[model samples]
Target chain A: MAHSTTLEPTATPATYTDAPRTGTWDGGNEPFKASYGKLMMWFFLLSDAFTFGAFLTAYGMIRHKHGVFTGTAKQFYFSTAHWPIPEKVFNAFPGLHGDLPLAFVALMTMILIFSSVTMVLAVEAGHRMDKADVQKWLLWTILFGSMFLSSQAWEWSHFIGGHEEGTRMADGTLMFGANLAMNQYGPPLFGDLFFFITGFHGTHVFSGVCLLVWCFIATTNGTFEKRGHYEMVEKIGLYWHFVDLVWVFVFTFFYLV
Target chain B: MSAHAAEAEHAYVPGEIAKPNTAWIWKTFWVLVAITALEFVIAFTLTSPDWRTFRNSIFIVLTILKAFFIVGEFMHLKHEVKSLIWTVLVPTSLLIWLVVALVTEGSFIGEVLSHMFT
Candidate 1:
């Protein structure tokens, strides 16, 4: 509701005390010494961490429920009775044949990390008010991020396409690739969790890329220059780093563990 | 505008941005890469079933180590005020409890499923 009293402009815009607060809890100052936007970004990231944590924890539970596979890698086969080894499922690589194990995913991880580095570089450039450097680093970050997404797309396709032979289900029908309902992998839940968790992370990456583009545009437009601060770059840098951090965990739990 | 409103709008002046540390950023990147490489090596080498627990634990520890660098250096959390650091980290520690409780319950259900279906 609009308040007429508050909305009306006063003759003198009353100035507040510029004196330093005596205590951290004194209501007038930023106790954390961070801008409101930065603090909120941290909080948002914290909340997002919990969301991913819940997903991974649920993944761990479902994985534990399915039980670990005891057979050697070579001896392992697609079956609903036992959980499939991650390496076995994710072995395919682009333009290569045979089992490459965790190679492709590792490449994806590196791409994301590199992008994160570029993002931080961009943020650093922003702090110096170097518009050229900011645009340069942001471009690199966006490039690397797009590379990661493309790699993920390839991985997902390879996963969904399955091998030509395919695995025979209990009912004698041959199943190819993976979907929410059934997969040639092990249990249906395996395919389901893989898609959901990684898909969620992928969505975050996609959005992060879009944000980087926006930051790049703003940098070119001299928006932050006019504002006398590049805090916007820092905020988006936080988000980009958060995405990379989530991938580190995902790499471990989803693939390695 | 009223004094309260004026104060509200102008009270929060942001502090100066910290100086950039390019060297630290590169060092952190190398550290992350090294840790990830180690993970891959372990995954490829430790294939036996008996080593599963040990391997998983190592992976978890290494992942946490990587997380420290990413959050601390890349996200610049380590440079923030102490209160901000605690606020971000304290709430995250609850995930440990969540993991323990849910995972324990999961194992029990898993045992039931294995018995029922097999």
Candidate 2:
């Protein structure tokens, strides 16, 4: 919702890049944080940027170690024993469970994406000082965010609640997934790594939902309005967008590419 | 290159915010969504080797486009000062390179072990 207007400088930090705005900040403060709000946004984005970079790098490391873990049509997975395709393992449907192709996860992805959009709109509304617009969009943002968290919880339960396929070992513990002896899906590391990466992501999404809820309640309580600015929208917008940006990377590496 | 660079430099006079058209932004969103749908479709439907390659290419391109839109529009990177532009994209680019390099190394290790063990 950034207005395409003549860039005006209004007491922003001198470091505020892009063309200098025509407006100037008269409220004498440290130059860098012309608006403490925008500076805070930058700070949040930087920290979140590091978190995503770490996760994606770790994903790349693990995924690279595995050599062609997927096999189509039930053929042997690879030269070694094969692993079940991700498509197969992740294929779960709610009521229509007999046969489906990852519908639930797909729905979750959509909700997250939609939430990202709504959050942006909320921020835009903030820029315009339109409290009503902010409220409407932020409410949608909260709803979608909460739905995503619930969907993730369902997904995790389905994953962890399911039984391990292998029979009991000498000690009577069922050996499931890939391991040195059992070569189900190429290697045991696949399940460990898969759960770790997606689990980490899901945890972040959960935290993001909490933050969004806080923002929603604050908005409802007229917090931003009282502050006389919607910088909170912008700050929360940065976090929301980071969640989405990470998801795009996750979708590419984990699901598609 | 000079002409483009000079044009970019010349157009970037400070003060007035550059007002990109709203309609075009809407159009971009529609195009972005269409491409995303197409990406998922191609992902589900195509399995041929060449098709997979093409699909992968398209998927990456579309993802980049989607990211560009989010940054350029929603994050308002386009409106940010040039230094801000550098601050954001430079880190992102470095991270991408780092991922590529790390993956390449891991894949290479697999290739070596693949040959030796087999």
Candidate 3:
């Protein structure tokens, strides 16, 4: 009767006869203090991280099995005998010709990072319930996400099209472009990993863009305004940031390292 | 249900909602940009075969550093409850074992392949 008298409605209802309710884990309060949707987003991101980690790990193993080309940067050239240097392979920039290694990918990295900044700003505006600011920042985030996707498209086309002089295959015929079958870049595995990893990452960016568009529309429609909370923007913002986080690793392992 | 009780049912407790901090956001943006630029500089200058291992180590270290900021600040994971932070981070730490095992095994395979191919 003493415990029953002290029982608060906010606490989980007493079920056991003897056990005292600790209140934290009594099933009434959220232990993490996060809404279900937000916590689910974090878990989803965690699983997505493993998916990427597995791909990159496999790539590293295969790359190690095929020794890298250790010659000087000037001496480096595409060959089937060894792993090609990433800089030499990814050297092209749209509109600009010649060997400016990593410049274009660097530009893409900047674009992704900038978009992430905009996404957080949108979330911040949402916190204040500033619908207009949320829409504006969300628009910038979408624009940057699209720019990043376009940059990737150009990079992929360049990769698939190959260079002026293609690598000579084992059959003594010159092979231009890259496919799952072969590549001008080095081992066939090189092209395969490049396509799979970056393509998977690109798909994520595309989806993030689509989600942002939906969030933008919802803001325009004053849906969050009616709900009196902008948690939807926060949820999408988590996904957008996770995409950017994946890009950081992709940029490192695929390009820099 | 009475209005007061209904409101109480859904209310966020103190510190549940973070304050809007624009300045901190910009500061994090600059930090991310600076780290990325540094990575580019190292990539270009440290191109010699001799520095390959050392340079790669630096890149990985910097990458993890950047990851901290992106996940902690941008994702707002740092501001979340302690249990939530650990739930996300503790499981991710398992990736270290996967990277080590596979890469070491890959080198051994590389040794075997070299003999066969040659």
TM-score of chain A of each: 0.91, 0.72, 0.90
Rank ordering of all candidates by lDDT, starting from the highest: 3, 1, 2
Q: Write the per-residue lDDT of candidate 1 for residues A54-127, one digit (tens) a residue.
A: 99999988887876778788788888878888898888889998878888898899899999999988987777
Tens-place lDDT per residue, model 1, B56-113, is: 9999999999999999888878777789999999999999999988888989998887
> Residue by residue across A1-257, what tens digits does model 3's lDDT show?
44676656565545755566667667667888889999999999999999999999999899898977877888988888899998889889889878899999999999999999999999877776777789999999999999999999999999999988998888999999899999998999999999999999999999999999999999999999789888999899999999999999999999989
DockQ (C-alpha based) per candidate is 0.44, 0.23, 0.46
C-alpha lDDT of all candidate models, in order: 0.87, 0.65, 0.90
Candidate 1 chain B: worst-modelled 10 consecutive residues by lDDT: B1-10
Candidate 1 reaches a DockQ of 0.44
Order candidates by TM-score, high to low. Answer: 1, 3, 2
lDDT of 2 by residue, B1-118 (tens): 1222222233332233333223433454566567667767876787554465576777778788878876666666666567767777777677878777888887887778768956
After best superposition, candidate 1 residue A235: deviation in angstroms?
0.3
Of all true interface contacts, what fraction is found in model 3?
0.82
Clashes of each: 1, 20, 0
- State the lDDT at B5 in candidate 1: 19
